[model samples]
Target chain A: MEPAGGSCLLGKWGHPVLQAANDTFRLNADFFDYTIIALYFAVVLGIGVLAKRQVSSSIDFFMSGRSLPAWVTGLAFISANLGAVEIMGMSANGAEFGVATFHYFWIGAVPAMLFLGIVMMPFYYGSGVRSVPEFMRRRFGTGAHLVNALSFSVAQLLIAGINLYLLATIVNRLLGWPLWVSLIVAAVVVLSYITLGGLSAAIYNEVLQFFVIVAALTPLTIVALHKVGGWEGIKDKVQPGPEQLSSWPGTDLTGISDPLWSTIGIVFGLGFVLSFGYWTTNFVEVQRAMASESLSSARRAPIIGAFPKMFIPFIVIIPGMAAAIIIPEITNLKSGEGDTGGATYNDAILLLMRDLLPNGMLGVAIAGLLASFMAGMAANISAFNTVFSYDLWQQYVKKDKPDAYYTFVGRIATVAATVIAIGTAWFASNYDNLMNYLQTLFGFFNAPLFATFILGMFWKRMTATAGWTGLVSGTAAAVAVAFLSEDAFGSASTGLIGLSGQGASFAAAGAAFVVDIAVSVVVTLFTRPRDEKDLKGLVYSLTPKESLVDPDAKALPWYQSPTTLAGIGLVIVIVLNLLFR
Target chain B: MSTDHDGTTDTTPKKRAGLFDIRFVIAGLIGVYGVILVLLGIFNASDEELARGDGLNINLWAGLGMLVGAAVFAVWARLRPVVVPVED
Candidate 1:
């Protein structure tokens, strides 16, 4: 009836024009929501049906027939990287931490991507493998493959669950629709496209959505900047205050906050251990590597993906800053009980959009939000089906199933993942209250899993025995830590056990990695190597004729090519730290 | 099964020069970092200068350097050997 929920729109001056503009965003007794949502569904369905004709075999279905160009794979790669959790979580972080929230994009993501491009991609592409797990088996053993596949799947499911929850949250807040209605509708839309189009459909739709989301939101940022009086207005509103924003070496360094030990601990444990481990091993991302058209393309996907990856802070994080500025009255409210729906900084950006965006633009923003959600969904579903069809089903169940059968199973896996994600989404409706619960669950599997993958990759000495030991040990350590802690999250120290919840999981994971590496090394030394022929296909880089034999040719003294670029980038990054600090 | 048979051999290299394009990789990564640095330097430089309570300093040198770096790299890559040949 009114433009927005505030008392102003419904009051005496509430006219028909404003009401119509508001109604576009307003979920309704009217058919507007249905009409728009149905149009989205129809478009995806049409693409899926079209993609169906192109699906000739398992390869065609899972990898878009492996005929995708660099542009297609590149776009899909980006959309897959940014999901519902990205928009909601990062936006929330932006509101809470201000500019410091941007550190995750710059510090956490960008370097990791470049390093992945240079170091990790070469290894993966060289392996000539279908999946990261397959790469694991060639380097380590089947044991490594099994551990990686299961841990990765669990992580993906948790991610999907988080995404489903965020999507439901947005829809629920907008229309006052029940969570199940939203989750089910989302599940159907996602499942339909992925099942029909396979990875190619996912990639195609993702590329479309990538453009849609970026195009739609990019202009809104300009308008927002304009409204906020450009640069000076932004500075006046929030000036990088402490507790709101800080840089890498700022509060953590210089004794501004803590001792050197705590600072070092954050850098080592959080920065190197947690961050590097995730970027290198995480499947939702590495899956893109497998989809590249060439070794070089595979290598470039993560790096190319890094470019837009840096802009995420500009597009998503700054909006939260703007939100804080325009909605300063609610800044305290964000931290307090004055919140609507699920009260937290997570919903702050959505709250801003609800208040600020004019009529037609609101629809576009909503589409961007939905596009982000679908991108995450398509990425995870394809990954799940990939692991399921390739690793689990192929290894344990019907090893000799036809490609067509695997394609069929890939579709079935999508449905199965959708069902599990729906249930997890329902549980995640309480995510604001259960942040620790979600993250702790992730840390348990992720910590040890990361160790195994990293050790397997860099250290050729790792063995199957070490792999299994690390996998089991990490999970047990994570679970035990989570269980013993007074806080819902795992503590690194306990009076009884002398370990905190966070500390325990880290120690457990780290110890497991150490043990896994040691065991793998010792066992590999004693045990025999795999068939050298099996290892033949690995070697992803294409060297020149002279360089191919010389092993040192075209090396360029390490400071001329990627290394030089990365070094310069690092210097600029340091300068950025000083400036932002 | 037929598709598996028809799949390109990943084990063997094409051996031919320009089989996979090195320029694309260089151009792509260069373009990526280029756009990122330039945009971040331009807008964020102004913001940083403003936040420093100074008059508008656009980080003109840095911005220009970024553009030059990107263009030089892109042109250099095109001039380098073209590998990873497409169907075309």
Candidate 2:
């Protein structure tokens, strides 16, 4: 028998059982696998080449000529948001935390996506704004626009680099490829497509990637479920603590490790604040919706995405939960141990693929992994270029540049963003729990954003000064809460200021959101409101009836209406929540 | 909004052929991968390989599914090629 705690020791590999497990878990791809992966790359590059012909102007480059249909944009909408973190980290969380991780999908993503489609898209699409920050410029004036644009651009660059870093690390671990090799390859591929076809290239690749990832993962999930004896078998073998199994997080808050897993935190912080902020304000995701052929198409994009978003948890979360039972040692896989021994929780999906999948299927799964990482990085790169060129360079640095000039600058921005992303990735290497840090960073950026957007869209009385002040103050509040909580509770505390990671982020965002609203309301009362005529189509109350209604929507069958589709989506979400609960 | 050098508005819609569309890329990938898997499933099976797949050639089935998906995208693209809209 192996040692009690350190069973993953080098000597343990010699043991018969350990040898079998380790052999299967190592990189086992053959010539066939490499051929499949090479074919995928060739196809991606060819697509990039073909897409370049469509790019004649800055608008086409940045917004896909705003001509995408509902199905295309809708699929791309969800795919753009499906980062390496969503596939790997969510699975890691599933293995570690169990059913509670589903909250990130259902409570955290679905409702917000629906809200974006049904409520917010009218203002965004009808106004003919090129980007999310442009919406800010029209609604609140230049100051708010600058703040949002700068923050988003910087964040996108950092995120793109992180995506590169993650892809490299996963490739290094899975294929035994060197880190530099994976990074350069990913950078080259992403830059090629993004710079060539622009947003259209990115969106098309994203839609393609969505199917590839699903096809890749579906087999693994099916095989793993069969290996583990099915759903009941997974539950029986997992032997999780009560909190791990319970979806109603409030009931077993004390038993759960993270304070953020608390029902209140999940609902308020992830569900409301972060979800709304991200789905509504983040242009990386919303850019897909905005690219639709019509206002109604834009409205239907996120609604369509919501249906698939509901089912994603099954593909992503189940593998992790199954791994928890089948390869329990994965959860204990720590950092710093050599490649073979220290397989961390993040290796949950990888471990399952290695153990369960045969040769040809394994190659496809790895390709899917590559596709997901590229899709995520491409999304951020495209968003970064758009925001930098239009919002920053055009607005501030070089006003009245020709359409071609802006398009040229956008391509140049893609290269610059990739460089900065690499730098951020190198800097991020110093952090231990990169995903946790990312979540906190997201909270800081997004929480205050939702507050600003909600008030700006709904309340015409809100002043431009208030808009800028609320955003700045809300971000500051979130940052202050994160730092102060760590200091007060001691760095080692799991729940700082009486909250878990998600909870802490929620608290910070919640505090920031409240502070932004309070400050905005107080300041708006004292300040002058924008002219009602000036607010036409920009504010909810001032938008015209024609702009508000989707002419095609009324003509469509009842099931095809955005409202009915959203209702169906909500029903699925509620059912999933109940089933898991 | 900018006038052309000849002083006329540029009204030509920017649209590409369905073959050059990005969906074609999806089709090409799915088709290529599907064909490869189907070939492998039929001819290249050792006893160990069969055991590894638990006697079920998942490659053949998945490959067929992927081929169908590719055909759907191809048809969709052929039916409605992307057309770059006139700027509002």
Candidate 3:
């Protein structure tokens, strides 16, 4: 399995995988687009300069002064959310599964956003907290708060670095730059704006970038569609039945045999675990909710955000699907001899974009691609700075520090995060794949965190000991699945309403959740509960009325709670998937 | 955190969230974006024009229009609540 020619890992050449990696560093024929890439960096830096003064306070620095309206929030939400990992991941899915991959948008994003708007935001805002972790503190306890804050920050930073690495790969393909140059250029451009402007700059620039991305993507889609012929051509060229694009659960009429309940398990597990983990628990997402002016605004922001989320499939994935049809010959070019295609998911995209777009327009498209990549880096560094400054530094290093000190710490945190992220990017450069790396990293902790967030919100009996137990148990289970399972959890478990490969990870996490919940209930029942004083803060966030005991105070209903709404949203998502499929 | 009873704060130093005047502007901005998206969908160029490789041109026109339209609506929304803040 050493170097030969981009082919299968276990091919006749006995080294196809090695050859693929070797060719990756070799510049493609269409390289020499550096001028366009440089222009993209300049625009990003300009945004940073424009946003320099917006970071005067911790609130301004982290939450954009909490005065932004729905559209800005909506735009920023999509921009910040996509990241490099997301773009490449989605495209990779498209290349692999065809239009069926669009299910992520339909089943994962749209419903998640709508549910957040109608339910989760109210609970989060009602809690009246600065960050998602702070809400955990009020709802559960300090231990829950601290652990979640620390773990999520670390995991997200890792995700950010992975995203930067994916971005570097694409940039390298477009400009023929070396991997190190692409990584450094990306880090500098993103860090410069982020350190100077904080959340305000991130949001403002994100709003602009969101538009730019759409502009680039929508056109790319049209060109791709035309190049491949229309819907009729796609139908003729690709598989038309469930074998290619089944959105429903397994055992459909596509005649393709599937793993047992692969569709149901993957989709449900993702919604119950991955979606909940990300939207309900992650700091970057929940932070946007915190930035709203009112609980109502917070509740509504994700809904507005859902509009774009719903169409993301058409914009991002369809192009990949189109590329798959047209460029099937080149697909898997990196897989070594006798492999599916020799290309990895990462390379498949660049090869397609290179072969497709006209030269002048390539500049704009590449810029949009970079925007997607850089946005992730900027948002993460911002979120990481906030966590360190607010959660760690404020609590220990500078408890009584001035606002000036907080801002300074925030900058320092940004620099630290940037350095680590650059390191992560360098580490990832050694790997040849994007989807496998991202899914593996996310699978490690996503399930456990999702379980804890759900338990903490709905079931009051969950205690600190239980939180610790659940997180640990969940991590252990996910790790076990990673090592022991056949598909390794994420690959086989993915779909619209059920598990994909990600579900196995969630299943392990779910098992941990069950154990944690059971342990917590028993512990809470036997051990005396924490003082009612500790419970008071939590009660207020949940019961926002004249009194907690009031019979009719017009308090927010439980149906509006994110946990409950997700349950209801799951049904709608399943139906949508079935309808579309 | 000290919360104000009866929706008014007298002794608390922490700023509270509410239906402040900025809300109406926010609601207005939402409406503006909604309108632009609807109009774009309605007045969209033919699928053929889009398919024949005018992707950037079409997206540029539509996205710019959306931005300008949304910005104008947001300004109007901001101005709308000014005339009757208390009543609102």
Candidate 4:
């Protein structure tokens, strides 16, 4: 039980988990491929050892001592998010929905990230809170802090489990290994690095993983696109409709049959509510930006991140779209021509990779997949440990402990959370499309938290009691919607209407957001407001003008300035939307 | 440690994260893999393998592309090694 899942972690894990087909479609990954993966693991562990030497305090452990530059944190910001969900789940969406899938990128992500950088980041960075929960604690008192900390911790563990299950499933199918062995091995690799160097190790490894992911996926996309004649070829091949090529009013992508309601859902439910809720308030990504050396760099982190983000769907989603055309199993499944060969949309990326890549490149792609899954889980685990140790443990159980004690507590929390994640992976195994499950989790956790946060940050009059009540009621509303809606919880749902897939998650999110705002407003009007004196840097209007932007920023050129760079990002994304629309 | 001529000892290096600058690690690893893939592409290509993605020697082309990526990252990291103090 204590050997940390055996000493031979990489030796067993080095086998590329590529095939989902029975025997007819094997990955054919040879010696060079395994060697590449093995070498990548060596560098990954080596990074842990290097980063460990930098950690001497709790701040250093959990926040990288807030010393990382903007570029590193910026790259880490996006990389930490380039987990199993982005690679596998988005690609799955692509295989199912085609070019309409780009909505998740251009509409669902970029604008919110730019907004986080330009508008909301000032309060977060200007206030000297260690974690998002700590910020909540200062603003709303213990009730809100406890609720935020507990829910955020639970969400991280569950999301980490999703990454764990998919990685293990891939290993199980490809190598016929037992699920426990694969799960343990995958868990141990992330566990080793995070426990050793903490967030510093996680951030550095994320930057590496980001590049490996780009390098690995670019080849696969080019090859897949070449195999099909191009986007024109894919459109012609997957005939019978032109709707797949358009990004707006995506009835199929949203899982809502009515084009009008689907556009409303995509815009209000997804583009505004869920995206802002996740991108702005979620601590997992926020932690990266928080680790930056300067407030301006912190502010610039997400804006810098948005540049690469604008183009990622071209590589991720397009390949999945190609798979639906190029691969026989998926083609049959999409066209209803024959049996699906037991392949789901989740296997779209792996199926395509198995069909196209050669041995050496195959190894690189496998390593890339492994990097992404680990990056996602590592982000979750690192965030979990920080909140557990600092916000939960130190605040409630062991107050006034030495900083070193908290650092030790953080390491222990990482180990414990990784083990718990192994158990939660079972829950994720029930879903065929992980995006639905992930979106449901976000709707439940992030939507309500975003409502509580956005209200408190802007309105200053919202009291402590309003904060926790709004959070609880908002979450309950989302869960209630999920339960009443058709196909959200499978058998648990009442099948109340035709709502299904991403549309159901969006409905749940929308319900949470509206209910949370309404409840918070009502609760605030009834309760005593916090003193305006206490709301100095925490609230928008209360905060001084000087606190928001760096004084040195005025001297810097337009490209380096946060708002200027963000404007550039906005224009490019708008053009991308225009071109794709 | 020797004191300065002004008799002031140096501040502890707690703030310096070293110019080991993580980009070198990113570049070096990607470059190594790129080189290996290029080697394999050159040595182990059959006509059947060449015909897989429009007869384009994918491993070789991908390897070259990665090497270019590695160079760009390494150059970016070197040209602007940002470790000095800035306004808080």
Please name the candidate that would achieve the greatest lDDT relative to the true structure.
4
Q: In candidate 1, which residue ranges exceed 4 Å CA deviation?
A: A1-42, A239-245, A250-266, A334-342, A430-439, A475-534, A537-578, B1-88
> For model 1 chain A, where is the 10-residue window of minimal lDDT?
A1-10
Per-prediction interface RMSD in Å: 12.8, 6.5, 9.6, 6.4
* True-structure RMSD, every candidate: 11.2, 7.5, 8.7, 6.3
Predicted complex 1: CAPRI docking category:
incorrect
Question: Which candidate, 1 or 4, has the higher TM-score?
Answer: 4
Name model 2 segments beyond 4 Å from true.
A1-25, A241-243, A250-261, A331-340, A430-439, A486-496, B1-16, B21-23, B46-56, B74-88
**Evaluation by DockQ, superior candidate among 2 and 3:** 2
Model 4 residue A47 CA deviation (Å) reads 0.6
TM-scores for candidates 1 onward, in order: 0.73, 0.88, 0.76, 0.92
Ranking by DockQ: 4, 2, 3, 1
lDDT of 3 by residue, A1-581 (tens): 00000011001110111112224433232232344445556655665675574345777787777756555676677677776545655665566566656555665566657766655565666655677777766666666667767776776677577667767776665556788898888788888888887887787667766765775677577767777787666667654444556555433211124655456544565445555555656677667656765555566567666657767777777777677666654443322334444466545455555555444345556767788877777777777788878877786467886888888888988988888988877766665344343445454555566566666656655566766666666666655554453344334433333322344444544554565556556665665455555654354344545332223223546643334444555565566576567
lDDT of 4: 0.80
Clashing residue pairs in candidate 2, if any?
A259-A500, A260-A500, A260-A503
List runs of model 3 lying over 4 Å from the truth. A1-40, A240-242, A250-260, A328-341, A431-442, A487-503, A537-542, A546-578, B1-88
**Superior by lDDT: candidate 1 or candidate 3:** 3
lDDT of 1 by residue, A468-529 (tens): 66666666665565455443342332434434423333344455455545555666677665
lDDT of 2 at A64: 85
Q: List fnat, each candidate.
A: 0.00, 0.28, 0.05, 0.48
Q: Could you tell me how far off, in angstroms, the CA of residue A31 lies in candidate 4 after the best superposition?
A: 0.6
Among incorrect, acceptable, medium and high, the docking class of model 3 is incorrect
